[model samples]
Target: MLLTAPDETQVIAREPWIPRRAAVCLLICFCLTWFYTLGARTLVPSDEGRYAEIAREMAATGDFLTPHLNGIKYFGKPPLQAWATALVFSVFGLGEWQARLWTGLCGLAGIAMVYLAGSRLYGKGTGVTAALVLGSSFFWAGAAHVASYDMGLSAMLTCALCAMLIAQRPAASPRARRNWMLGYWAAMALAVLTKGLAGVVLPGMVLVLYTLVSRDWRTWRRLHIAPGLALFLAIAAPWFVLVSLANPEFPAFFFIREHVGRFTSDVHSREAPWHYFLPLLIVGITPWFGVLAQSLRHGVRVRAAGFDPGRFLVVWAVAIFVFFSLSNAKLPAYILPMFPALALLVARYLDSASPRATIVAAAPVALLGAAALVVLWFAPAWIDNAPASTPVRRGQVYWITGAAVLLALGGAAAAWLARRARTWALTVLAAAGFLAGQALMLGHESLGRDKAGVAYLAAIRSEITPQTPIYAVGQYEYALPFYLGRTLTMVHRAEDAMLLDLERRPHLWIARLDTFVATWEAQRARGIKAIAFVRPDIHADLQRRGVPMRVIGQDARRVIVTNDVTAQRP
Candidate 1:
């Protein structure tokens, strides 16, 4: 199948840029880089550590119905990803790569789906290009390597979007269309299970917008809504129903607070201005930002006779972008679901674009790379007083410098080759972008080590026994629990409602500094050994209060201490 536009189809047929063998080699290399790098870095905090720990706990306790983090009931998001990760952990022992395997596979699947969809909708060349574009796109590639809900959610949403497009194509047989529509519905169900309502809401919104924009009201007739809805509910409803039944508080918290409150208000303290995603979208697209701009512009103007897949794809990208932009809560990954559509659009645009346009597209990437180099050169001086150690800062600079150089040289080479060898030009740029992104990610391990508390792991293990009570005072190290394979006693009241119920789990929480001190004293009096991870300022305060503790490990962010003075210091 070819693009609906005759001219675009001709361009694709005339210029099959890259050789088939080379494309296969590039993809094989990508898969190696993608999977091999999963264990290359420590899991960073907030999302990576949180999700991995939840899955670890789930696997350990054999509680798949409800998710828990740090041994506390957590309903912040759905459990599909956690369930998958937990299953992985159950089969393979817990580790960095094992934790990220599910997300990585989802990311790989998204690339394959984009390739298939682009191939069917546009042409074989367009499909191959789209896969390269998505597999190397900085944000898409980076998010896949991290253990998070966004990749899983985005992958399913991409599946739904691609299935719908394929199903609604003018050339699809009735049986083929029905099967694809059912797949679309099932993908949406899995998407809803991956995140929350946005999984369903985003796609539903895109459908409405696409129908309105294309004036293709008849599109709804082909959706097989009755059977599709039945399939969707059959797949998505069981977990929500069972979990809500098991935990009475699940309904309001998961539906109302997490979905509605997170979107409509700044309750999560993640609010950003309306134009927040604009810069992210630009940078996240990386070397392809120029192509994206061209794609959107061309996609809007292109018209087709029957069902317009390009128009639908454009609407899908725009609706999702606008939906999240208007939201009170903003995150870099929140807009990820729109990327696959953008990839298809960009692939279509590249298929028809002149060599001169391709060269023009390569210019901005080169310029951005140069600009990044300049920023990195002066960044150290600008942040001379920053808390990070000089060696850490130097290492980060080196890694970024390598990435910038790759971008700069690759972009220039792609521009030089665009007219003579379009296929090679695309391959060079994609390889650079992919490697640069991996470099940036691997470089972060320098800083992620501290954030992940990996440096203190040996000290922590040596000082504490399996049954030793570990308390988190004033601050919680999200990644440490996952590393240590144990949960910490949260001394402070957790900000998340799911952390603990103060009324019911009063014994589990030490609400005040004084209370923690008293508890420490009582434990010491009973000849019990206890370990606590305390913030530096909190540690100083405890020292002033005459608390008896031996410092076992120390870092700028945290101080690990034990009540047993005989414990060896690190």
Candidate 2:
């Protein structure tokens, strides 16, 4: 049953593949899964715990102007996300879901913007498919559920991208163009506040690339630059002005060292190879890899006339990819802004693709699913000999098994329906991709629990009062401060302590282990209650040195100890 490609013109005019009611139902289900899973797992460290704690501190201290983590001033990024999350905490009360609410909303907003842009740029079908694709994308979905700066930044950039597309369309009225262009500028400002200059820089780079590639110089006339720049400055300037007035050192550190130094040098110790994001991008779009290849190929063919949006989107995605790839410091989520553009491109390709092409796309998904099942089958035997792996592996097996089954069955079903029911086939694949991503994230709680230190909260809380002094000696548990509703004093952790203004507040930072030991001895002599969270190896060394401490709780990562023997649990 060989099938030939249909005429491109005819395919463009065909009716939408999905019915209206079904689209609505699918959207409802997606929303349920998205928000329902926000609190299903503990907040993981590095990004999740860091951002959440910043918000928690902001709310607790009522100092929204300057962000702080573990009681020291933190100026690594702008305060927009922390401000939003702190507001959520003020109204909703503190919890995992409350901390993550803002990020979830940002993710939802990005999907909505994509749907609107896709519908207007291509058609209703393309718009719907684009939203589905973005909402289900493994990286986008996972990042959205976690408390972080990336999703908020990505969502604002998506708004800017969509607003520009809407404003520049050939059929747009003068008033509509003016309004949407303002929206584009405002989104860019929020994006700057969300992360930094990359918000505006990345988009500005795309515009330059798009103009050069598409030769659409006249498109600039529709941007309403005077008012757009005014709006942008109005929104993004005040914070910089206020923060700089309060802290003289902010301008240099934020602009010069944080942004420029980070990109040009490896000061942050996060340097990676140029190809670091390649694997991330590949896995980021899971089942959609086949469609992505098709879309990029389709995007290269220029239309004969007016605004070449396809070319613009291609440049938008490629330029951002190249920009970050060249940077000295790289993280997985640095390329998140590219996902929305890729979704739009993939949506356009799927709209006009033949059934045979759709079936081909399903093949990889099915194969990947089978491979996952095979790995899961032997996982137990492989980890059986390792004592530490047993609990975590056993807890995760059910989730991995369920995800593999969903992907396997969904791919097969989509392939079976492609010949006669194109919409249903794509919808099934998107749903499976979404659910599988959620399952994997939920399963990560097994490991996240250990890192988060939430299990030790009970014992630690029972021993301490609000006035008790807590010190993180030789290590910092990123998640513990938020759970405890207080910050820990830094001891011998120079990397984070270096960010503070040590000239005025030298006591806040402990630069040497001997200094920490002396302080502990003095506090114990004064009969002042103090607690310390120390790494296991450091705890053993301190114990061997005859430091007066009693263990209240112990975990593989850290040991919670107190100076008073009565506080220790039997």
Candidate 3:
């Protein structure tokens, strides 16, 4: 019996028996791959530490509804992720792993959703393959372990889409369909809470397009829109109402600015060309890029009579992909919401695509290893111009070299196994590739440690006293507040939603650079202690102005300074 990628006929013909233990084993492997060295790296700035600090503030103030940063109103995002992190922090006592555990859990749940959806729509083989494809994808795995709202939003969207697809099936019983509809509503509501309006808008667009393209308007009747809408409102509305009532500025900042403005304008200065996510998707999928391309190509074909799941999945994936592409704001992780559908579609294709195609697909991944080898050998030359403390570690090079070798070996093994055992080949290749990629990410943590401010914070921890007012002048480091166990008073740098907070509470924020300098001088004259975080350029400028600043600590990112009187006293 010649083993080849299944065709449409072969897809229906093949009954690859996937044992119950396969799911259990997959879950175990997922935990290992996703959570490995999760806490080994310090919390990265401006996102991970920002979210963690918000959660810490929530826990400290005992306020779950209104999210605050630096003791001021922060209405940039809703409080779902902050709430979850606060809960984790409460029980786990506020650590890196605790902060990111929610995201990691969401990532795992997303992989599970794809598995179940694939199993129900195609077969167990397709289901398992889809799970592996998504669970091991470079972007998915990497995003999962970070402390961000994207993972939570992606997970909820996956649940809503997968549950909706399952509910629309002709084989679904009345009760089963109703339950699935309810689940879909709940998922969308949670998604709304996770990331403002994109949660509902993107899914709504996909559903509308799918209805028109597949000519399946009758599917709407089964959606139970009245109850579904009620459920969605029930879960998603109270937070908006409460937050708005509590902070009168919430409505304008959240809906108009965060949702509409963020999508249409380059409000955050995150502008990119339409093709930004193209290379991201290719690199994101990594070893599975070959199979994914074939699967997506096959996804357009019409199949099944009542509700075409293939077309629907394709629509779901493509709609979101194009939605972000058309948006003015572009980030690599913005396309994360589309990955689940892509995984299912890829699983469908791998069920019947050619064995030769699978082998050919593994070629790029093998080459990726060779590239890593080059990077490993040239690490020193590459980072020569970096900061004095930014030297590449031998361990990082070793890890990269090992990952490259592992990916190459996995690709080689898959190529050989594709001739006789395609399923085994894919599974082995996925596990090896995912583990190798994870190792590389873990290894790279050291490169950013200096800039992340863990060491600098430790160096200055004892110098800070309860009465000493610490100011973050000109810049903010997200990790600093969390590590210091308090917030920094902002001076001359209030951007994003922080700008709105500054408006609400002027006293908490210093708007003028000159005002901060005068205050520092006055405090030093009175024999009061004061400290500030300034950028290197700002430090140089202050020196030129003869401000008599004493640099207690410095790094590539920021310089920690004190008034000369404070330095002399302590």
Q: lDDT (CA) for every model shown?
A: 0.87, 0.86, 0.82
Residue 10 C-alpha lDDT in model 2: 24
Clashing residue pairs found in predicted model 1: none
Could you tell me the lDDT of residue 368 within candidate 1?
Answer: 80
lDDT by residue for model 3 (1-570), tens? 322323222245453544569847876766775675577677887788889999999999999988988787888888899998898889989788888888988998999999888887777788888998898788888888889899899999999999998888776899999999899999999999999888899889989999999798998899899999999999999989988898888898888998889999999999999999999998788778877766776787646677878888999989989999999999889999888998888878777667786687676777777777776677867566655554456657677788889888888888888768787777877877788878877887876566577777755676678778899888887888887878889988865788887876799989888898899899888887777889888888888888867777887689988885444534
lDDT, candidate 2, 1-570, per-residue tens: 322322212226655667779778877888888999998889888778888999999998999888888777788889999999999999998888988888999999999999998888778788888987898889999889999899999999999988998888776789999999999999999999999998899889999899988789998888899999999999999999999999888898899988999899998888999999999998898778877877887866635246766778888889989999999999899999999999988888888667877787677888889899999898888778766758888889889888898888888888898887888888998898899999999989989988888888998898789999999888777898888898888788744424556545778778788988999889988989899999899899998999999888787889989998655455
Q: Assess the local accuracy of residue 424 in candidate 3 as a C-alpha lDDT between 0 and 100.
A: 76
Candidate 2 whole-model C-alpha lDDT, 0 to 1: 0.86
TM-score of 3: 0.93
Q: What is the alpha-carbon lDDT for the whole of candidate 3?
A: 0.82
Clashing pairs in 3: 5-352, 5-353, 6-352
Off by over 4 Å in 1: 1-11, 374-388, 499-503, 568-570
Candidate that scores best on lDDT: 1
State the TM-score for model 2: 0.96
Q: Rank the candidates by lDDT, best first.
A: 1, 2, 3
lDDT of 1: 0.87
